[model samples]
Target: MGRMIVSVQKSILVGEVSAPASKSYTHRAVFAAALGDGKCCLSNCLISEDTRSTMKACRLFGGSFEEISDKIYVSGFGKRLKVPDEIVDVGNSGTTLRFMTALSALCGSEITLLGDASLQKRPNTPLLETLQKMGARAYSKNNNGCAPLVVEGKIKPGIYSIDGSVSSQFISALLLVCPLLDGPTELSIHGELKSKPYVDITMDVAKAAGIEILEQIEQTDPTDPTDPTDQNKNSVSAKTGGKISYKIKGNQAYHLENYTVPGDFSSVSYVLAAAAMISGSDVDVKNLFPSAQGDLAIIHILKEMGADISWDKKEGTVHVSNSGKTLTGICVDAGEIPDLVPTLAVLGTFSEGRMEIKNAGHVRFKETDRLHAMATELSKMGAEIIETADGLIISGKGGAGLFGANLCGWDDHRIVMALFVAGLMTGGTTIDTAESVRISYPRFFEDMKKIGANAIEK
Candidate 1:
């Protein structure tokens, strides 16, 4: 396909849309099922480039997938994984690369993990170091702590410590593998953890698969260098100087069962954001579970920005409408809402007052440096944004609106989708590399068009 240019004809967007299945939940559920006993049926699993990468990795571990209607049947390895015959390629999927790196250590043979250009640039050093400490000889070929990694499987489960500030994927990766080990595994995390909610998702999947993980927070005592557990004393909290510990019993089996994936709050944020920005627009997004998703904070964030939004938990729907009222900006903490940053940034450009998005420094290590990419791309469209060390400061022009401009997706799916929403508001925005949306939401443009968004793909 050639490069696509998106423009809108109608300023008002109105329609009902169904949110895509959660990509993060689908990955975890697939992994759980692949490692589980017997045949597992997964409903509402996302079929995307990223999740497909995870499926491929599962096949490498001797698991097989069969699609029956909307449900996927996964025959697992049952804790016995065979070394893949060829290199395992995780194309542009950091979740697949990170999770598979730790899982590969369960096999007795050497296995190599590879990824596309963007995925290869993502840092996996923390995971590699943690696996090595667990008796697995894992390392990056180029020694850059990125992909193209070789793992000699022979994991000796024990206590492992890693810094949590980089990415929560490292913690989740270890959590998945620890229960399958030969001995008990304990993980201690140092530093302030970002993306903590992703870990909650991991724990949810693990629990559903019959795995029990004991978690605790211990405060650090600067005066006492001794172990806090041994002293039986309360120390500093996680906010100040504390560490989170997860203990898993080894030799645990994952029992297979039917699992249903929830709607993706990350993907639907774009729809809600577009509805809130466009005048005379009313949109309803269905099949959402707000409590289970961290990105659902988008609704609360949008409401804080003076947007008309409501959630019907019983119906699992979110309704958003502008109704001729303008959105007002406010300060936001992006630590738990990293996936919503791009869309939130787009909304900020059209809202009133200055929007400060802070605590999202970790987003730089995603498919692209999201913070910098948003600042640069939105600026090209006349947005007043300042990139900071940990976040962004966006000065909304108080409904004065942005002019259409040519933009690039930077090959990031979220970036492409967020820019598309912005394009609907501006009317003449052309985004190159629009195909990147296939990584998560393949029918993003189609869904937007159904909601009266005149996005011409040419």
Candidate 2:
């Protein structure tokens, strides 16, 4: 693909669209299968640039994968990884770089991993420090806590601690490797664990691969009845800034017969938002069965914004239409739902009041400074959005809709897609870095066009 450029104009969308497979689940499932003891088949895996990086990394670690009819058959090395002949290039996939770095500890020799410029800027000090504490020689080659990381093998199992205020990927990276260690491992998380739902996804996938992880939540205030230990208590301790501990037995073998990835709520948020923002648009996004995805909060966010949307959990479908209701703004705590911020920001453009997004500073650490990207790009289209230190404060136009202008995608998939959604509400919008959509949903423009979106590559 060349430097992709697209022009989008306002149009009424009306149709059913299938949500893409979950990229988060696809990454975890593929890694789990690659570490399994036997053959595993994964269905509905998201075939995208980021996930393809994970697949390539898995292959370097002695896993064999064959794709056939939307499914991948993987033959895992079962804790016995081969020292790769070349340096692992994760190619813009932070998850791949982190998870594969942890897995490299099992290799008999040293394994070095690196990524593109955007990914190299992401901090990995928390993960590197944790791995070193766990008896592995892991460090950033540049000594800047960012990538071009190197690790030497045979890490012994023991208790390890990592600061969780940064990316949750550090915690997740350790979760994927500790189960196969030679001895039981106790992992402790300190400080606020940003994006905890992502850790939940990792645990869910590990359990599906026949690995058991015992989780315990230590309340800052023990008197609080909403501790996760209590099955009846469904509230989160994230607001209180609690600690989490995980216990995993050693010498565990991963085994998966068949695993099917779920529909991606993160990717479909743009689709659902388009239907909700435009009048006379009725859209259904299918295959979105609920799991541990934090971005599933989009449906609740939409409903809270007064959008006429309904989600049928049984059928795994989300329906969105105008319904003659005035969409208003609401304060959103984006601590658990960082990925939805861009979509929420665009939705705020069409609302009747102000939408405040908070507790999302971690989003700055993604492939790009998403907070800055959204604020800058949306501002070009005349959106009154304030770029806060941690989040965005979007003041709705009160039906004085924005006019289209030149936008930048920042070479980040989510940023590109969110801007595309904004483009639909304001005609004559031109966006660069349009090719970045291949990182997640390669068919986004095509699918949107099927539902009557006036978008085209020029």
lDDT tens digits, residues 76-119, model 2?
Answer: 98867788999999999999999988988877578889999999
What is the per-residue lDDT of model 1 for residues 76-148, given as tens digits with 9 covering 90 to 100?
A: 9987777889999988889999898888888867999999999888888888988888888999999999889
Worst 10 residues of 2 by lDDT: 226-235
RMSD of every candidate to native, in Å, equals 5.1, 3.0
Q: Count the backbone clashes (under 3 Å) in each candidate.
A: 1, 0
Alpha carbon deviation, residue 154, candidate 1 (Å): 1.6
Model 1 alpha-carbon miss at residue 331, Å? 1.4
Q: Pick the lDDT winner.
A: 2
TM per prediction: 0.94, 0.95
| Model 1 lDDT, residue 163, Cα | 79
